[model samples]
Target chain A: MLETGRLDHNLGRMGERARALGVRLRPHLKTAKSYDVARLATAGEFGGITVSTLAEAEYFLAGGITDLLYAVGIVPSKLPRAARLVEAGAHLTLILDSVETARAVAAFADLRRVAFAVLIEIDTGEGRSGVLPEAADLVEIGTALEQPPYCRLQGVITHAGHSYAARDLETVARIAEAERSGAVRAAERLRAAGLSVPVVSVGSTPTALHARHLSGVTELRAGVYMFGDLFQAQIGSCTLDDLAVSVLATVTGHHRDAGHLLIDAGALALSKDRSTADAPHDYGFGLLVHADGTPFAQELRIFKVYQEHGLVRAADGALPFDELPIGAQVRVLPNHVCMTAAMYDRYHLVKNGALAGEWTRTNGW
Target chain B: MLETGRLDHNLGRMGERARALGVRLRPHLKTAKSYDVARLATAGEFGGITVSTLAEAEYFLAGGITDLLYAVGIVPSKLPRAARLVEAGAHLTLILDSVETARAVAAFADLRRVAFAVLIEIDTGEGRSGVLPEAADLVEIGTALEQPPYCRLQGVITHAGHSYAARDLETVARIAEAERSGAVRAAERLRAAGLSVPVVSVGSTPTALHARHLSGVTELRAGVYMFGDLFQAQIGSCTLDDLAVSVLATVTGHHRDAGHLLIDAGALALSKDRSTADAPHDYGFGLLVHADGTPFAQELRIFKVYQEHGLVRAADGALPFDELPIGAQVRVLPNHVCMTAAMYDRYHLVKNGALAGEWTRTNGW
Candidate 1:
C-alpha cells in the first residue's frame, strides 16, 4: 500500500465551516475523490454528500455514506444507472434542465417503478447548464412532471462556476448573489405555482465561501474548497496555507542548460485546465512546492508536458538548469484541483505533513 | 452490459489505408480508456500503444499488451511505479527531456536494482517538453549516467501536440512533417556523438495521420484514432465515421426557451478538454448521433453543463425544443476522446448498437 503521508483535517474543517455558515453542506465529492474524505465530511453533521459521477454516488453510497446527490446534468444514457442507485435505497437526487430529460427520467421511473427526487437546474449566471432566470416554464414543466406520480421535482439548484473566472472577489460575490437569487426565484416560482419546492441550492467553491449569507439558500454545494488549487489561490479564495490537496510528485530530472527541473506530474497528473481568462497567470500546471508543503521560491511548472515527462520551466529564468538534486520528492499544487484530482485514483493522505491513512477515490460513471 | 455500438468501418478502414501508405501506426491508449480497444488497435496492426497514465500501462502490460510506451514525460512521483512495472517484467519505455530525470532515475534504479529505459524528449516545433535541437551535451550527460545506473538513455521522442491548433489541414500536415524531421535530426546528431540511439519517435493524432512518411522515424505515436472527437474532425484528421468511441447518454430534459436538450453527461462524464483548435463545422461538446450511428444534419451541443445535466443547444436557435422525444438514447461524441474515456470505469461495449460486454477500465496511481 502507498503510505498515507499526512493527516487531513479538510473534511472535518469543511463540515464545521458549513455548519458555521448555516447551510446544509452537501460537500461535492468531485474534489476530495477519497472515500475517507467523504466519510469525514459526513462524520459530523454533514451526513449528505454531492457527487459528480454516478460511480462516485455508488461508491459512497456503498461505503456507508448516504444522502447522495448525483449532481450532473441528467441525460438518458445514465438514467438506468441512476435508477439502479435509487433502487438500492440511495436518497439520490439528480439535476435536470429540460423537459426531454424529464420524459426520459419519467420513463425510467415508470419502468423501474420507483420515485426519484430531481432538482431543476437554473442558470443564474454560470451559463453552463440550466434554465434561464426568466424561464418559468422550465419550472412549470418540471413540476408538471410530478403528474407522473413517479418523478418528483424537489427544488432548484445552480452553480456559480463562473466565479472561478472572476476578475476579483467583487465579481465572485455578484455571481454568488445572482446564483442564490436565481435558485430562490425558481423555488418561489414553483411554490407560487402551487408546487412544493423544498430545496433551494447554489454552489461553487468561490460562491460557497464568499456568498456572504445563505439567505434563501438552504443547501450549499461546493467542492474544490477542501483542496485548494492554483486557480483558487489566484482568486484569493484561500491562501497557500489552506491548500489541502496536491500531487505528491518526485523530481525526476534537471535541465542544466535551461536551468529547468523536470517533474513526474504532467498534464495527466495535473490537468490541462489552465485558467480560462484573457490574462492567464504563469502557474505552470501548479505551484511546485517542497515535500513538507512549504512553497518553492522558484516560479516553476510542469509546463510543456508530454505523455510522461513534465518540462519544468523556472520562472526565475536561470540558465544551465541543473539545480534540483536528483530523486527529490516534490508536491505540485494543481492548476484546478477538481480536474487534476479526478485524474488520480487515490490519495496518499498527509496530516500535519505526516503519514495518515490511504483514502481511495471513487470512479463514478 | 452496455452495448458496444457498431461503427461504420469506413473511418477505421482509412486507418488501414494510412498503414498501407507506410506511416507506422502507434495508437495512444489515453483515448477510449479501454484494453479491449487496445487489443483491437494491436489487431488493427497499430505497432505499439502510447499511454498517458501509468494505470493504463499497468493494465495493458499485465493483460499481455506488451510493447507499451508511456507517452508522458517521466517524473519522479511515478518512478517507484515504473520500477514495479519493470520488476513485473514488462517491456516498458519511459520518456524524459532533462538530465535531472536521468539522474533521479539512475539513483532510483541504483537503490531499487531496476534498469529503466528512457527516451530524451525533444521539443520539435511545438515548444512542449523536450531538449532543444542543440542540446547534445545534456543528452550525453544523461546517457552517460554511471552511478546506480537507474535509467538508460534511449533515443528521442517529440509530439506536435500544438498541431491540433493548426489553421488548416495543410498547416497540420506541415507541422507533422516538422515533428518527425526534427526528432530524426536530433537522433542523428545524438548518433553522430557515438550515442547508440535506436528509437526516433514522433506523434500527435493530427500529425500522425497527415504526415506523408516517417522517413527516419523509428516509431509513430498516435491516440484518439479509435475515437475521433469533435476536435479531430475540426482539424480534418479523421471523418465522423472514424470516431469509434462516444458516451452513450440518455436525454433527460428539454430547455423550451433556448431550444436546448439536457443530457446526463456533465464534465465528469465528458471531461473538460475542449480541443484547442476551432473546427470548420459546428460540433458541440460532441456529435449527438442516433443509436444507429447516423448523425443529424442539425448541430447540437451539450453546451452549458452542470454536475449532472448537459445543456444541449439546437442548431435551429429556437427554444420550446419539440422534436426530440423523452426517453431516447443518444451517443455523445466527445470534444477530446482520451480524457472523456478516462472518466468512466468501464466501457459499456456496444456492437451495432447492441449490448456487447462490459470491459472494465483499470485505475490506480
Candidate 2:
C-alpha cells in the first residue's frame, strides 16, 4: 500500500531539492512502475522520465509521457522493442557502455530505419557498469554511436550507485561530486573528439539529495526518493516520516510462546531484500506499524520470513498480542520499497487514514 | 524460461515416488503458478492441488481445477474472497493454527452461508507457523470449526519447512518422518475428539523427495520440486540436472577489468533470494549457464546484483568474456526458483533446444 500524503510530501521535497540544484528532475520510474505515481512525480516537470526496462518505457509512452531514457545497458535483442517505441512516437534514449553495443545499436537503427538517441554510460565511482570517465573506450563508444545516420549521440550519463553505501551525508556529497565530474568529463572528452554530447546526467537517491552542486550536470535522476524505505532513512536520504509505501498485512497467527506474531506478508509479499541488515538499526525485514500509519510504542520487526509468512517480534520488548489479534491489519514499512512493491500488482492508495483507491503497476522485462 | 523436457521428467519422477510411497500427490501450485504446469503435474491424479495464495486458488479454479488447499493461515479479511471462490465451485480448504482464526472463519462461513473446509496446521518443527502437534489448542480450533453449520473440519496438515536446512539425505529423511508423524498424530488427536479427520497431509520439497515412509499421511504436498533450484540441489532434494526453470538473460555489458560480466537479469529479474548463501557450495545469486541449459566450463555465478544488472563472475577462474560478448544470451539457474519465478509474469517454454511457446502465470494476492 501507498500513503499518498507521504508520497506527495516526498515527491515535493525531491522536486524542490532538484530545483535548488538547478537540474531537471527526471524522476526514475523504476521504483514506482505505476503511471499514476509517474504522473504525480512528473506533474510540473517536462515529463522526461527514466526507466529500467523497455516495458516501463512502453507503459509510460502509452500513458502520454514522451521523453524517456532507457537507463539500462542496451542489447541487440531489446532493440526491436526499442525501435517499436521510437516508431510509436517516443523520444526514447538508449544507454550503453561498450563500443560493441554502440555498434549494434547503430546497425539495428539503420536496418530498422529508426532514429535513436544514445547515451554513453560513464563509470562514476560505482564499479557496477559503465566505462570509466577517462577511459579510451569512452570516445570509441561515442564515435560508434555517431556513425549511423539513424543514431545520434545524446551525451553521457553516470550513476553513483555506490552512494547507497554512504553512512553519512559527507560521503554522499563526495560520491555526488564524483558522479557529476565523471559524466561531465566523459561528455567533454566526446566533444573534444568532435562528437556531439548534448546531455550530461548523473544521480542516485542519496547523492541526488545531498549533492553539494551539480555544476556540469543537465539533468538528475533518482527513483527511491519518491518512496522512502528503511535503508534510505538509515542512509540519510530520507526520514522515517517520508516513507510512502508499505505492505499491508493481516495478523494470521500468534505464537505467544515464541513471543512473535505471524503475518501474511512474507518473503514473497515483502521481498527478501535484506538491504537494511547492515545498517546501524537493522530492520529485520521491515518495521511493523499500525494500520493507520502510526508507529507502535514498541519497535516491532519482522525478524524471519518464509515464502508466505513473516515472523514479527518486538525488537526490545514484548509483543502486544492482546491488542493485535488474529485478522488484525498491520503495515510493514519495507527495508527496500522497490523490492517489496514489485510483489504487488497494484497499490492500495491511502489518504487521511482512509483508502483512496487502487493504482496498477507494470512488471517484468 | 522452463524446459518442458526436464519439467516432464521431474513431474514423472515425483509421480512415481508418490505412487511408491502410497500417497496422493496433491502437487503444490505455489511455485509454478501456471495452469499449464499444474495440468502437467496433475495429469493422471485426482486434480487436488495446493496453493499459497487465494489468487492462485481462484486462477486454478478458473482453469478447471477445483480442489485447492490454501496452505497459509486463514484471516478474517480474506474470508470474503475465499467465500467467493467456494461459491464459484471451488473446494477451497483453508488452514489455520489458532482458535481465533478458526472462529473467525466459522463466523464468516456462517454469515455468508458458505460451507468452508478447514485444516489445522501442525508445526512439524519448522517453527514458522502452525501449532505443535501436541498443543492443547489443536482440539479447541477443531471444535470451533465443527460448531458452525457452514464450516467443516477437513483434516490436519503440516509442512516440514526446516528440511530445507538439512545438509544430507539422512537428515531430510529424518525430518520427513517427523513431519509425517506430527500430522498423523494431530489427525489422530482430532479424531479421538469425535471429529472426522479424513486428511493427514505433510510435505516440503525435501521431505517429499526424501521420506522413507509416509505411514499415516494421506497426501503429500511439494511445490519447488517441480522446478528444482540450486538450494534444493545443494540440500540433496534434487540433482542439478532436475532443475527445470532458469532465467534467460541477455549480456548487456562486460567489465573485464573487474573480471565480471553484466547481464540484464538482476535483483528484479533474478530476485534477491540468497537461500543458498549458507550451503556448502554457495551459488551466490544464481548459477550462470549456457543458453542451451549446459553449465559453463568455468562455473560462472552471478555474485552481485543491482536492481537491473547481475554481475556474473567465475567461481574459481577468469570470466569467458571472449565467448560471452554484449548481446549474447545466457540462462541462470536460480538459487530458489520460487522467489526467482515470482519476478516474471510468463514463462518461455523451451523444448529440444528450441522455444516451444509461452505460458502465463497468475501473481499477487
Candidate 3:
C-alpha cells in the first residue's frame, strides 16, 4: 500500500526542486505509472509527461494527458503505433539516436501524411542507447530528421542514468553538471549546423537534484523520485522515510531457531532487484518497516526471497518473533520502487493509518 | 512467444520421466500460468496441478482444473479467501510449515465449519522455508493440523530449491537424493507416531531431472522445466536448444562505434534475473537469438539493460550489426523463464517457424 502523506510529500519536494532549478520539469511517469500520481506530479507544473513505452503513452493519454515525450529510443517497426497516437490528436514526441531511425520515422510520417516531432538522443556518459555527443552522426541524424515532409526536429535529449552509481551528493552533482553540459553542447552543435533544435533536455533522479545549473538546458526528466526506494535512500536521493511506495506483506511463518520470519511478499511482490548490494549499506532485498511506516529494529531485514516467500530475519541480532506474530502485516521498502510497483495492478493508498483510496496502475508495453 | 514444438517436447519428456519413476507428475502451473499450457502438461496424466498462489488456483479452477496444490505457505489472513475458493468447488490443498499456522487454519476452519486439507512443508536442506525434517516439533505440527472437526493432514511437501545451485549432474543427483530421503524420513517419523501420512512430495527443476529414485515419494513437483532457460541450460537441467520461452523484441538502435545493438526487451521484458552470473556461462540478462529461434554469433549477449532497453553486444568480438539491422525481430532466451514470463499477460505461440496460437496468462495475487 502507498502512504498518501509520504506520496504527497515526495511529489511536493520534487516539484519544488524542479522549480528552484529553473527548468521545465517533464517528469517521467515510468516509475509511478498511475494517473493519480501523474496528476499530483503535474499539479503546479507543466502537464508534459515522459513515458517509457507506447502502452504508457496510450494509457496516460487516454487518462487525459495530452503532452507526452516517448523517452526510449524509437524503433522503425514501432513508428506506425506512434503515428496512430499522433493522428488521434496527441502531442507525441519520439526520441531516437541514429540516422537510420530518423530516416525510418521520416519515411513513415511522409507515407502516413502525419506530422511528427522527433528528439535526437545524445550519449552524455551513460553509454547505453544514445548517440555520442561528439560523434559526427549526431548532425547527420539531425539532417536526416529534418528532410521529412511531416517531421519536425523537436530537440536533443540525454539521460545520465549512470548517475545512479553515485554514492554522495558531490559525485552526483559532478555527474549532473556533466549531463547538463553535454546535452547543451549537443544542442549548440545542432544549432551551429543550421538545425532548428528547439529543446535541450537532460536528467535522471540524481542529476536532476544535483545539477549545479541547467544554463543552456530547456527541460529536465526524472522518474523514481516520484516514489523513492532503498537504493534512492542509500544514494542520498531521498531519505528512508521519504519512500512513498511499499509492499504490504503478512507474516506467514516464523523460524524461532533461525531467527527469521517468513513473509508473503517475495520476489514477485518486492521484486528481485538487488540494486543496493554494492552500495554503502546493503539492503538484501528491502528494509522491513512497521505497517504504519515506522522503523523496525535496525538489524532486521528481508535478506532472502523466493518466488512467493521472503525470509525476514535479523542480520545482526535476534529476531523479535514474539513481537511480530503470524498474520501481522508489515511494509516492505523495496530496493527499486519501479520494479516492485510493476508487480501490482493497483495501489491501496493509506492515510492516517487507514485506507484513503485506490489507484489503478498499468504495466507492460 | 512459446515455441510449441519445444514446449510439447518438454512436457512429453517430463511426463515420460515421471512415469518411469513411478510417481505422479504434479506440474507446477506457476511458470506458464496459462490454461492452454496446463492442458498440454496434464493431457496424458492426472489433471491435478500445483500453483504458487490462490490467484493461480482460482484462474486454473475457472478453466475447469479442480485439483490443485497451492504450494506456498499460507498465512491466517488468507484463510477466508481459500475457504471461498473451496466453497466454489475447488479441491485446493493448502501448505504450512508451523504449528502456529496449522492451528490458525484449524481454528478458522472450525469456526466456519469448513473442511480443509493441508500438507506440512519440510525444509530438506533448502533452508528457505519449511520445517526441518528432524525437528522435534514436526510431529507436534502434524498433530495440530489434524485437530478438531475441519482440518486434515493430507501429506508432507518439500522443495530442494538449492538444487539449482548444483553445477554438475553428480551434484544434482546427490541433492535430489537428499530431497527424496528427507521428505521420506519426515513421513516415516510421522507414521512412527501413529499418524497416517499419505503423500510424500519433493522436487526442483534440477532435482526432478536428476533424482536417483523416488521409492518413498508419491508425486513430483517441478515448474521451470516446462520452459527451460539459460540458467537451467548452464546448470545441466536442459539443453540450450530446449528453451521454449523467449522474449520477442525489435532492434531499436545500433551503436557502431561501441559495437552494440539495442533491443526493446530490457529488464521488464527479459527480467533482471542474473542467476547465471557465477555459472559456467554468464548470460548478462538473456541470450539473443533470431526470430526463428536460431542462435546468432555465439558471443552476442544482452550485456546491459535499462528498464526498456537491452544493450546487446558481443562479449568477445564484433557485433553482427550489418546482419541484424534496425527493426529486426530477435528472440531473447531469458535467464529465468518464471520471472520473465510474469511480466507479460499473454504468450504468442510459434511452431515449425510459423505462428501457432496465443494463450492468455494470469498474474498477481
DockQ of each two-chain model = 0.37, 0.81, 0.77
Question: What lDDT does candidate 3 reach at residue A252?
Answer: 88
TM-score per candidate? 0.82, 0.98, 0.98
- CA RMSD of all predictions: 4.7, 1.3, 1.3
> In every candidate, how many clashes are there?
74, 0, 0
Stronger candidate by TM-score (1 vs 2): 2
Candidate 2 stretches greater than 4 Å from native: none
Instruction: Report the TM-score of candidate 3, chain A only.
Output: 0.98
lDDT of 2 by residue, A143-255 (tens): 88996579999999899999988888998899999999889988889899999887999999999989999988899999999999999999998889889999888998889
Give the share of true interchain contacts found in each model.
0.48, 0.85, 0.71
- Model 3 has an lDDT value of 0.89
CA lDDT of every candidate: 0.71, 0.91, 0.89
Taking the tens digit of each residue's C-alpha lDDT, what string does model 3 give over A116-234?
Answer: 89999989898887877788888999998996559989899999999999888999999999888888899999999999988999999888888788898889899899889999889
Clash count, candidate 3: 0
- Shift of residue B97 alpha carbon in model 2, Å: 1.4
Model 1 agreement with the true structure over A1-365: per-residue lDDT tens digits = 12222114455555665677788888888777677777665666648889877778888878877688877776666778888887788988888777766767777887788778888888887655678767846765565557456788888888888887786878888888888888898888888778888899888888877776778778988777777767777887776677777777776655554556666666566666666223257675567777888876666666565434567776766622344565677777777777777777777767655776666776665
Can you tell me the DockQ of model 3? 0.77
- DockQ winner between candidates 1 and 3: 3
